[model samples]
Target: MFKTTVTPRFGDIDGLKHANNIAIAIWFEQARNPVFRLFTPDLDLSYENWKLIMARTEYDYVGEMFYGHDVEIISYISRIGNSSFVVTQEAWQNGTKGAIGRSTIVHYDFLNKKSEPIPDDIRKKLEEHLQNEDNSCK
Candidate 1:
C-alpha cells in the first residue's frame, strides 16, 4: 500500500465548500504515481517507452470532504492481469472515507497501438502494494 496527501485548493471546492467531485479524481490520479513509476522508471514520456494507459476508471463517493484540510489517499494494486492491473484507491478526510476508486491500467505498446504483456519485473513490484482481502490498504 502507498499513501499520499492532497490539499484541496480554493478552486477545488464547490458552492457547499466541499471538495468537488472532479477534484477527487485528480487526487486519486496523483496517488497512482508509484504505479506509474514502476512501469516507466525514468518518467519517460516518449511513445515507444511509455508503458501504461488507463483503460477504465470509476469512483464511488462515500462521504463529503471539506476544503479546510487535506485528504489522504491510499492506493494499491488489488488485482493483476496479463496486460493490466487494477489500482484501488480511497480518499479519506477527517477520519472518514470520502471516496473509493478503481482504475484499469493496461500495459500498452504505443508504436503498435496495442496492449502489451506486463513485464515480469514490473509485475513483481506491483505485488508489493497488493491490497489485502479485508480492503485495508496494507
Candidate 2:
C-alpha cells in the first residue's frame, strides 16, 4: 500500500465547505503516481511511448472533509491485467473514512490505437509490490 498525507487547501472547499469533487480526483492522481513510477520511472510523462490513461474513476463521499483537515490517501493495486490495472484507494480524516476511490488505467500504445501489454521489465517491478505473497497474478 502507498500512503500520502495531503493538506486540504481553502480552494479545495466548495459552497458546502467540503472538498470539491474535482479536487479529490486530482488528489487520487497524486497518490497513485508512485505505483505507476514503480513500473516505469522517467516515462515521457505524456501521451507517448508509455503512460496510463484514466479510463474510469469513481469516488464515494462517506464523511465530510474540509480545509484545515489533513487527509490520508491510501492506494493499493487490486488487479493487474495484460494491458491495464485497477487501483483502489480511500481518503481518511481524523481516523474516519471520508471517501473511497477507484480507478482503472489502461496502458496505451499512442502510436497505435489500441491497448498494449505492459513490458516485461515493468511487469517484474509491479509483481514485487503485489499485496499477495504468492504473486499468483503474474
User: What are the per-residue Cα lDDT tens digits for candidate 1 across 31-122?
Assistant: 99878999888878997888899999999998999988989999988899999999999998888888999999999999989998989899
Model 1 root-mean-square deviation? 1.3
Clashes by residue pair, model 1: none
Winning model by TM-score: 1
Q: Write down the lDDT of every candidate, Cα atoms only.
A: 0.89, 0.78
Candidate 1, residue 21: Cα displacement in angstroms equals 0.8
Q: Model 2: how far is 66 from its true place, Å?
A: 1.7
lDDT value, candidate 2, whole model: 0.78
Worst 10 residues of 2 by lDDT: 129-138
Q: What range of 10 consecutive residues in model 1 has the weakest lDDT sum? A: 129-138
Number of the top lDDT candidate: 1
